[model samples]
Structures are given as C-alpha cells and as structure tokens.
Target: MLLEIAIGDAYGAGFEFCGREKIMRSNTLESYVPHELGIQAGCYTDDTQMSIAVAEVLLANSDYSSDAFADAYVRCYKRDQRQGYAKGLQGLLDLCVNGADLRQRISPESRRNGAAMRSVPLGLIADKNVLAQAASEQAMVTHNTAEGILSSHVVALMSHALLYDKAKLVELPDFILEITGFILRGDWAAEVECDALQTLHAVNTALQANRCMSTLLLDCVNFGGDVDSVAAIAMGLASLTPEYVVDIPASLVNGLEAGKFGSSYLRKLDVALAGRYPVLSAHLVRQS
Candidate 1:
C-alpha cells in the first residue's frame, strides 16, 4: 500500500494539471512525465506527503489518535508546501498554526478529494472501525463535506479489506458493495453515496483494484476523473495483496533526481518496501 501510495502520488500529479485533451492524447502513462506536463518528477502532491505524515504518526503512536495525526499533518505542511495540497487547504494550515483543535477546523462543508487522497496509510495499521475513525479524523481537519469523508472512508476500508484478506480476492466486488452499503447507511448529512458509488463504478469498470496487482496498477494508469484519487484508492487497495508490492519502473526510475529530498525519500522508501518489478511492460490501456 505504501509503495502504491508513493507511485500513485508520483504519477497522478501528471493528470491533475493536464486537461482531458492531453490525457486522451498521451500514448502511455509514462508519456505524462512531469516535464512534459510542466511539473517536475518526484514532485508529489499533498496526497502522498500527508500519507507519509499519517504513517509517521502511526509508527510512533502505535494507536489511532486524531490529535496526533493532526499534529503530524501540521508539521508536514509547515515543512513542505508542495505536498499536492487541495482546495481550502491553507485555512486548515492556518488553524493548525494557531494551535486550534483540528476537530474544530473540520466539518462536512465541502467535498474535495483531499481526504480520500491521503487515506491509504491508515488502513495499513488499523481494523475497519479504527480505519474509518482515523480516516474521518484526518479529513475532519479541513474536509467538512460528506463526500470528502465518504471518499476517505471508502479508500481506507477498501484498502484494509485488500490488505487483510488474501483468499477473498475473488469476491472483490461483493466486498466493495458490502462496504459501500455499510458506509452509506450511516447518517452523513449528505447524499455522498452517489459520489462514492461513482468512484466505485470507475474502479470497477476502468480499474479493478481487487483482482490482481497488475490489473489495478494498469487500471490506475488509464483511469480518468480525478485520476490521482482513483489511482491512490486503487493502489491502496491493491497494495493489500502480498504479491502486489510496488517498485519503481526502471526507464523513468533512473531519470529521477536523487538530490531532491522528496526523490531521495521516495527512493529510500522504494528500497525499503517496493517489490522487484518488471523492467518495462506495455500499458494495458490507452487514455480514452
């Protein structure tokens, strides 16, 4: 899940800034290089950066604590602005700087992908209930919309389901549906069930995050409509598979600048966590 989070963070940024025309015209996922898209490689958005913050908190606390997660987030934001921030992210940053309770800052007011983008890491450490709680808390800091919280919860649960069970691979859709049903049943103040279902539909029709690592990885490479969020969710879910660990692709991998701290950190994280990947493989799909 960590490796997927890393690579998805790296690759998803290409689509965040590119229009649909360029996305459709691109021949492969590799074609959307940071430079071609006018962004730099190894420059991840807030999704992966915030995820690392969550991981850091989990690593030290060994338990779920919303305050701890928020503090870690503030620390990261203070350190790096290039963390692929979302709409209204600055307000949350400001609140943190003012020593405000993170809980007070977050409410269901808007449905940005911010919460969902950084949700995978929490799934790695907690069970479904705890994962949902942590995901909610993480987003509550700034994302106040029902859609925002639902997206985060969905990603965390899906990732948790994927990571914890190996034998249930064949029942992926059922699991998604079941979890989706469970979440939608809660009183979230808005009908974000539709939005969550749309994302699930994208994952199902375009990127199958449950069947195989290769399937989900390839799906992420081609999926549109908040591709980073889709890719992040897919990677998070896919990373749960013991066989689906992510490794940097070699061709573009070598071009990564080592001097940049983000690049260096990702490289080290790859070395520590990524699996041995194929040299170069054909993209499974073309941009639509």
Candidate 2:
C-alpha cells in the first residue's frame, strides 16, 4: 500500500499545480514526467516521505506515539527538505526538531492535505475500530483543524476498508459522503467541502464512467489542488483492486528514489508488518 501511495505521489508530482486542461492535453499520462523540481521523473514528494516516517515509528514502537512520530517527521525533513513539503508542515517539523510541544505547534486553522497524505499507514496497521482514532492522533501532530482531522480519518478508514473489501469500491463515494457528513454535522456540515471529499467525489465519478484505473489515477492527480495527496489517497484505495494493481506500471515502482529511508525502507516495513499480521501477509502474497 505504501508503495502504491508513493508511486501515485511520484506520478502526480510532475503535474501537481498544472491545470486539468494542460494535463489532459498531454499525449500520454502512463509514464512519469519530470516536474519543476529538476528531480527524476519518479521521485516522490513529502507525501511518501512523511508516510514512510509514520510507518517507521509504527514499526519501531509497536504502538502509536505522537512524540516518536513527530521525531520521525523531523528526521525525514532534515534528511531531505527538497521534497516539496508545505510551509505549515515545515514549520511544525522545525518546532518538533527544536523539542517544542508538537500538539501546541499544530496549525489548527490550516486545512492542508498533509494529514491525509500520510495517514494511510495508520489504516494499514490498525484495525477498523481504532483506525479513526489513530489517524486523528497522527494528524493532530501537525493539522489540528476539524477539517484536517476528519479528512485524514476519511482516508484512513477508506484505505482500511478497501484493503479488506475491494469489492466495496463501487460504494466508495457514498461511503466517503456518509462518513464525512457524520463527522461534520450541524454547523460544520455546511462548511466548504475539504480536499479529501473532492478527491472522493472525483473517484465516484470515474468509477461510474467505468474508466480504466490508470485514467482514474490521472484524473485524481489532475484535479488541481493538493494533487499529490489527493492522488495518493485515491490511488491507495484504487491499488487494492486486482485490476488496478496490474495498471501500475513497472517504471513507477522501479523508479522510486532510493536512500536510507526510501523504497527499500518501505519494503522492509511492509514485510515486517506483514510477518506480524498473517492477513496482511496473505494479501501481499496475492498482490505478488
């Protein structure tokens, strides 16, 4: 799942801020294209970096610790700050590095996709009942707004559900709407829709049209705002389906940036977690 998320993030990184019309004008969306960063075509952004950080903390602690996760985020940022991290997240990570209280440092009013981007790991590692709580706890490390937390929860829950029940994907949009509506009731319900909801709505539209998974991924990335995060969350759900798994190109997986905590580290975490959880091991075997 982390690999899929990273691949999606990398694929979309090049088109992050491009308009939908420009992306649609491209000849082929199957292969990666280099973004303005001057990095390689398949290099992932802070989305995968922060997600790997979360997975590392989860694998090391046997339980979620906000401080440890914050430390991991700081460490990853220090290792590579060129992964296009949002200014708000960079500020929070700086505070974490300086030993500040992370909870207090959170940007409660800013509703960026940082939380949703990295929250998939919690979904993979946690059970359904505890998934939302874990997502909120991790999200609150940087994004404390109701919108941010709820969006993260929606991604986490949807990822978990998709992993176990790929057949339920047809109902994903309604599932997202139902869950988001329940979370943001009354006054909050009338607020503007968050990026996570917009992503899911796009997914619902694509599913209804019977589009190919690759096209759906392209559409998600081309939605314009928070492209990498939205595509990561959407791709994480889409990747669980057998058809979509085949749609992921070999170049994307082979092209992930490599280092101490890069693609190799993600694989190690996946194997370790799968070993501890037989169900995940079986799922991995099926994927292989």
Q: Which has the greatest lDDT?
A: 2
Global lDDT scores for all candidate models: 0.55, 0.64
What's model 1's overall lDDT? 0.55
Residue 261 in candidate 1, Cα distance off native in Å:
4.4
lDDT of 2 by residue, 162-215 (tens): 666554655665666666673321111111123554544454454344335566
What are the per-residue Cα lDDT tens digits for candidate 1 across 1-288?
444565565666666545557556652545225635445764556767777787666656555566677787777777765645555665667566632454566554656666776776665643577777787777766565677777777766665665555424445656756776632221122211214445544544433333454445445545554566556566655555544434445533444335444556654543433222111011111100
Model 1 off-target regions past 4 Å?
Answer: 35-38, 91-108, 167-170, 179-197, 209-218, 242-248, 255-264, 267-288
Model 2 off-target regions past 4 Å? 20-22, 25-27, 37-39, 91-106, 165-167, 173-196, 203-212, 243-245, 286-288
TM-score of each: 0.73, 0.81
